[model samples]
Structures are given as C-alpha cells and as structure tokens.
Target chain A: MKAIEIDNLSKSYNKGKVQALSSVSFEVERGELFGLIGPDGAGKTTLFRLLTTLLSPDAGRATVDGYDIVKEYHAIRSRVGYMPGRFSLYPDLSVEENLQFFAALFGVNVEESYDLIAPIYKQIEPFRTRRAGKLSGGMKQKLALSCALIHRPSILFLDEPTTGVDAVSRSEFWDMLAGLKERGITILVSTPYMDEASRCDRIALCNEGRILGIDTPHDIVRGFDNRLYGISAKNMFTLLERARAMEGVVECYPFGQRHHLVADDSFSVEQFTRQLSDIEGLEIASAEPTIEDMFIKLMKR
Target chain B: MNSEIVISVRELTKRFGDFTAVDRISFDVHRGEIFGFLGANGAGKTTAMRMLCGLSYPTAGSGSVAGFDVMREGEKIKRHIGYMSQRFSLYNDLTVWENMRLFAGIYGLNRRETEERASALLKRLNFEAERDTLVGSLPLGWKQKLSFAIATIHRPEVVFLDEPTGGVDPVTRRQFWELIYEAASEGTTIFVTTHYMDEAEYCSRVSIMVDGEVRALDTPARLKQQFAAESMDEVFRTLARGAQRGE
Candidate 1:
C-alpha cells in the first residue's frame, strides 16, 4: 500500500496573495526514502506542514497512511513523526528532558522506545545532561530526530535536516536516516542542497510552489538532453561572460571554479577552443551533469 | 596580487571559565584572497571568528586585523572591516533604499555620496525595482546579495562572511560567489566560514577546526591530496571523525 498520497493539493497565504502550493500531487510508497528538493520559498515547508496536519490546505486532498489529512488529523498525528526545518525543542530543558517530554506526549516511555532511537540518540547521549540550547547544530538535530523517533512512528517527515551543518555531520545524519529506512519506515525529507538529493530513493524537484519533475536522482540527471562542457581559464569570471556570449552556447553557469556550458548541435570542442585560444591557462573538457545542473535547466525551462 | 597579510594571528585563545572555546589557534589571511574557516558544529570556529572580528575578547594570546591590534584597537579594526552574519542584519521594516542609506550613514558617508552610491549599487545588482520595496518582502537570495553589498558599502579592506550562503540555492550561490570574486578582484580580502564542503573548494586556502584547535590547514587541492580524499567532504570526514566535542 502507498505510505502517503496527495491529489490536487493547493494552499495560499496572505489572502491568496501567495500561492504556497499550486495543485501539487505525489505519492510515496511504503518503506521508500522520498526527497522534496528545491530552493527556499519553493513550497517545501508548506507541503510538509500540510502533510503533518499543522496547516490546512486551501484546496485538494491528502492522506497519511490512508487517513484523510483534515478529517483524521488526530489519528494521523499519532502514526507519524515530524522534524521541522527550524529547531523547535525547548531551549531551557536538558536533552534528556526534551526526549522524555516528547515521549510522554506520545504516551510512551523512553525505555519502552529506547531501541528505536538508539542509533541516533547514542551520538548525543554523552551530552544528555546538557541544555538543549547549549548543544551544537549537529547534536541538536540528532536530539530532535531521537525525540521524533521515540514513539516509533511508521512514517517520518524531516525538513532540511542537514542544513547549516558541517560536511561530516551531514553525512552522519544521512547514514542515520538510511538506517531508519532499513527498518521499513517511510521517510520524506526536504533539502535545498542538490547533492543530498542523490541520497534519496526518489526526488521531486520543486519551484515556485510547483513540482517541476519527479524521479530517481539518476533518472533526473539522465534526462538532460544537452552536451555539457566544463571550461575554465586564468580569470574564471571573464570566462563565464565570454562563454555565455559565444555562439552555439545554450547555457553557461559557474559550477565551483569551472564554468559549465551547455552546447547546441553545431557546437564543437575544436571551434570552442579556437574561439578562446587567446585566453591564457585555458582548460576545457566534457563533464557529466549533476543534479544541480538538471535543476537549473528545469527551472530555466 | 597583493602579497600583504591582511589578518595575522598567533596562539589565539578564548576561554569561558574552565571551558576553552578557542585554544592557541593561528592563521594568516592575505589581501584579495578567500580564506575559508571550516569545522563541525560547536568546534570553536565561531569562537575564533568572534575573537578575530573583535566581537569577543580573547582570554589569552594576541591577533591583529587590518593592521590594528585586536586587543586594544577593536574600534579601529571595525572601521577597516566588513561583516555579514548568517542572519540578515538589515532592518526588516525599512525599504531597500532606506536600509542602504542607514548603513551608508553608519559608515560615515555623506548624504550626497550615499544617494549616488546606493543608486549605482542597486542598478548594478539589477535591484532598482526593489529600491522602495521593504527588505522583508524580498526573496532570500536577494536579501543576501543586498546584505553583502551593504556590508561592503564602506569599501573596507577585508570582509568577513559567516555562512552567508546558508539556505540559498545553487544558482544563487554561484551568483553570490561572483560577487565575492568581484570584491576579491578589487583587493578586498574575504575571510569566510561555511558548512558546505563544496564551497571550501572555492577558497584559496582553508582551515578546519575541531575541538578548539586547528586540525588541518591547506589549499583545497593540497588537503585533498594529503588526506587521499576525492573531495573536501571526504577530507573533512576523515579528520572530523575523531572530533572530541559533540560526541
């Protein structure tokens, strides 16, 4: 059975001045890791809020584990876990207290659900006595995840869980999420970082409150139709402008120190090299398309 | 390229009672160079930046920024440097032009100069239409761009960006880096801290802090080579896997 389903979901704020979600629809299969990938203000948070029953959608319908979102919110609430983008745990409370409080609210004891949260909780267990406010960003996120899982929900919604975290912490967080998926939990995560999208089982590319595309990370990158070339020179800024103005160049944008240039059918590496031969320290080579490149192309389309 | 050292530090230390937030860290930032400060959460990166920016006093050791002593010349240091934090620091209620005018005033620019510079900056950023719009209403990317512009309005010798690209998209991030590059090209030294490993590759040199100490410091290529890693992310993981803090 599907873990969750949405049909014609729509929402607006500021008296319809902002169309937060525009008739969005998608499905997450049972035990799948689903990712909502987009930039900020792309309706990611609104969609999560709607699924978690925190906000009512203006139109359309959605169901969590076969329960209608609006009419059966109470029942849905007990079956799912949610970690908001912003840190929401009580600052004055110690890490242990926050976990206990969340467990009690769910009518469960920490010992009763200890096994479910052990992998994540163990990382922050050493700092259990520390106040939630004093914990670091990565530790705070781990604590929040543990609290959310203390009740052993079958489904989890994490909104930008790895944002503003160091590279090491981010990889560790993903490893924890993957472990959770192994226990047959349906997970829905949202992030602005394109690299994280590859870690998900499937991703929905969102923009301006709409899903631009939905597919596996590999499939999304494979969908890019243009030949891309990575080009660089002594002065990268000048190289970007020059490449953008060149003929047969469809799109050009900086990716790290190099510029990624998309070419048309008439484009050739030889012609491109000859065009900028005067430039010193020039380097050009064919490059593979990444998820970020695909997202930019989709947004432009 | 200016080989002059814009920021120099030696054995910089900061302590809160018995807790050592920063312990004997030292580094140098060169003029027109992008220096990245990286670390795990609660790894003393912020504490060290606070000391260098003169926002917090060191418990021991010494440092200098913009040729002024960090110990007794914080005011002089502030006047020669720009800083943009993770949070947008502009007044939300103020219009774009108003915020620009306010910052220009804070930087001691004359009324006529403020008006001219603000207009020119808005035009250059293609934000002329947002001149009268409240800064709160603009998108996150625009707000960040404007914040960077505001931070450097006085043309300080060096600019400190503390995770300035947090929550922004890849496209916008690339554009933001263009601004950083532009500033650096004009001889404005950039000392930045970021959590994004990919961003670390863009820096001329990077320092990774762990548990109040410098664990690794080198160019992105050299660090990756030294660690036998493919990317900065791997290098960081290899080093930070032994982090003493945050368990």
Candidate 2:
C-alpha cells in the first residue's frame, strides 16, 4: 500500500463561496520526498489540513498508511508531523521547554527522540534556554522542525516552510528536510518558490486549487514542447512589448535580466531579428525551460 | 548613462545603542533607474530602507532622497516618494475605489486629479468592473497589482517596493514586473527589495547589504562576473554566505 492515497478529495469554505480545494487527488510512496508547488491560495494548506484530519473533506476519501483519514484521525495525527506555514511554536516557552512539552504530550520524553531530532536540534541547542520567539528566523525554523520531529513521526507535512525566508536560509531549511528524508520518513512539503521545485523528487504544480501537472522536475521540463528563447535589449520593457506584438510569438515574460519568449514553429529567428533590427543592443538565444517556465505554461493551460 | 542622481547617500549609519543596524552604507540611485536593495533577513536592509524612507532617523552620515536632506527634511522627503509592501499596503475592508481615494487624499491630490488618476488606473488595470469590490475579496495577485498602481498614483519622483511579489504566482509576478517597468519608463526611480534573485537581475543596478554594510553594488551582469557566479542566486549566496549574522 502507498504511504498516502487520495481519491477526489474536495473542500471549500464560506458555504462553498471559496472552493479552496477542488477534487484533488494524489499519492505518496513510503519514504519519498514529494512536493506541492504553488503560490498562496493554491489550496496547498487545505489539502494538508484534510490529510492531517484537522478538517473533514467535503467529498471523496483518503488514507494515510492504510488508515482512513476520517476514521483513523488519532492514528494519523500521532504518526504524522506537521509544520504549518506560520511559525506555531509557543512564544513564551524556551526552545528546550517547547521540545519537552511536545514530547511529553506524545507520552514520550526528549531523550527518547533525541536521536531523531539531534541533527536539527543541535544547531539550536545552545539557545535551549532562549524563548522560541526570540530566536532568529533560521534558528526558529530549526527549532520548529525539532519540535515536530520529537515524536519521531513516520510522515512529515511541511507547508511553505521557506516562505518569507531568504534564499540562503531557505537552502539550509531544505538541507534539513533532506536529512529528515534519509531517516525513511515520507515527506510532503509545499512551497511557492519554483526554484525549490528542483530539490523535490516529484512535484505537483498547483494553481487555483487545481493540480496543473505532477512529475519529476526533470520530466516536467522535458515535457515542455514549445521552442522558448531568451531575448533582451537595451530597453527590456519595449522588448517585451515588441516580442508580444510579433506574429507566432505565443508568450513573452520578463525572466530576471531577460524575457523568456515562447514561440511556435511558424516563428523564425531571422525574421524576428529583421523585424526588430532597429532596436539596439538586442540579444537573442535559445533558452532552456525551467520549472518556473513549465509552471506558468501549465497554469495557463 | 549619466542620469541625474535622485537618491544619494554617503557613510549613512543607523544605530540602536551599541548595535549598528545600518553601518556606513553609501550608494546613489539615478533618475528612472530600478535599483534593487537586497540582503538576507536581519541583515539591516529594513533599517537602511527605513532611513531612506524618512521613517527612522539615522545615527550618523549624510544622505538625501529626492533632493530632501535625510536628517532635516524627513517629512518633505516622505512627500516626494511613494512606498508599498506586500503586507499592510492596502485596507481589506475598503473598496478599491475607496482605497484609491484614501491614498490619493493622503498624498494631497486634489479632487479632480484624484478622479482622473483613478479612472486611468482602473482602465489600465482592466479593473473598472471591480471598483466597488472589496480589496480583501480580490485574489492575492490582483491585490498586489492594485497596490502597485495605488502606490504610484501620486506620481512621486521615487517609489519604493518592499518585496512586492512575495508569495505571488509566477504569471502574476511577471505581470507585476511589467507594471514596474512601465513606471520606470515614466521616469520614476524605483527603489525595491526582494529575496528572489531573479527579480534582482531585473534591476538596472543592485546593492546587497551584509552585516549592515553595502557589501556589493553593481549592475547584475557585473556583479555576476565579479563574483564568478552564473546567476544572481549564486552571486547572492557567495556574498551572503560570509555574513556573521545568523538570520
């Protein structure tokens, strides 16, 4: 049996005015690192709440570790660790106190799970006496992960762990997740960052509560069939407008220093260059499609 | 390339007791330039921005924003620039039209000018139909776009965006940049901060803060080459990795 199984799970709020999740379904293999990649309001959190049994789905059924989410809520809650999008540790409690509290709540002591959380906890161990709220963002993240793992959950659900964090700290958080994954924990994480999609074994590109596509980051890029090019000029704004106006150009988007222009086979580079010959310092090159490119393409469709 | 300098700082410093939050940062942002101000969390990017925005008084150094002296003309400086952030930029309960009118009024725009600007902005955003809709009801992407329009409504000489695209979707994030480019082309000097390295590359020039200092400042192309990194992310990582602070 799969570590997780969902069949057409649906959820909504405000008497169906919101429709937070719409018939979402996916599976997770045991000890696999799966990612839910999407921006805010993409229902990533809704799905997490449903699987964690915090809220019953409006329709459909799901199971974690062969246990029905609704019927086996107790089993699921005890076996799964969740780090919400927001920092949720007690502000008044010291780092060590919070860990001890969580462990005791689960009928275990800190020493029982010290081996499971030591890798993450040791970094913040020096601050054991500091209030959880007083720690820095990076240290706070480590503490939250440590508290979540104090019970040694078989599966982990991290919702937007890297949101609002700097790139350096985000990379560090992912490294911690990787370490946790190696301990044979089934991990399901969500992020709004397209760049972090590459770190996941498989990702579901979600938007507006719908899964656009689900595949390995490599396979998703390989699935992009359009001929995309990176085009830049002295005036990037004008370049974007001109690229969009040209016939056969499907989409033109500003990507970092240059614009990623998607074109059909009918488009010819020679003709494109000839058309924009008047534009100065123009540079064009075939570009590789990234996860962001694929996510945008899939979301549009 | 010699555009007029709109924002100039020299040895600008901000301190709280013994801790120096912004330490001797110096840079000049030219007119109509999109200048990216980047740094890790708790690296003093906020303190420096607060000083430039005339919100917090600096401990030492000299600077001017939109030609207003930072030490003396803080209120005058605030009047000449616009500011927006992902959070707290808009009121949830207010309708789009109401929000626009509120900001326009706060900026001291006359009644006629406010109406004209509102109509033009609504048209540009294709949001005329939603004028009466509550801002809280709009999607995250739409709210951000609307916030940008409102921030620039006064047509200030400079506008500062604080991570305006954080948590926004990919498609809408690009759309936000187009709005930024349009504003810059209209001769508005944009001072922005972001964690997205790709967005950093969108700037005409970028200044990265490390330990309260302007550690790296250059065009994205030059910075990448100087750091021997392939992407802005790599360059940022190289500079930020050496920081002594832990956030």
Highest DockQ scorer: 2
Candidate 2 Cα deviation (angstroms), residue A245:
1.0
Find the candidate with the highest TM-score and give its number: 2
What's the residue-level lDDT of A115 in candidate 1? 89
Please provide TM-scores, in order, for all candidate models, with all chains considered together. Answer: 0.96, 0.99
Q: What TM value does model 1 have? A: 0.96
**Position A177, candidate 1: lDDT:** 91
Q: lDDT of all predictions, in order shown? A: 0.90, 0.92
Q: Give the residue spans of candidate 1 off by over 4 A.
A: none
Candidate 2: tens digits of C-alpha lDDT, residues B1-247: 5479999999999999999999999999999999999998989999999999999888999999999999889999889899998695799999999999999999999999999999999999999999999999999999999999999899899999999999999999999999998989888999999988999999999999999999999999999999999999999999899999866
Chain A of candidate 2 scores what in TM-score? 0.99
In candidate 1, which residue pairs get closer than 3 Å at backbone N, Cα or C atoms, i.e. clash?
Answer: none
Query: How close to the true structure is residue A269 of candidate 1, measured as C-alpha lDDT?
Result: 86
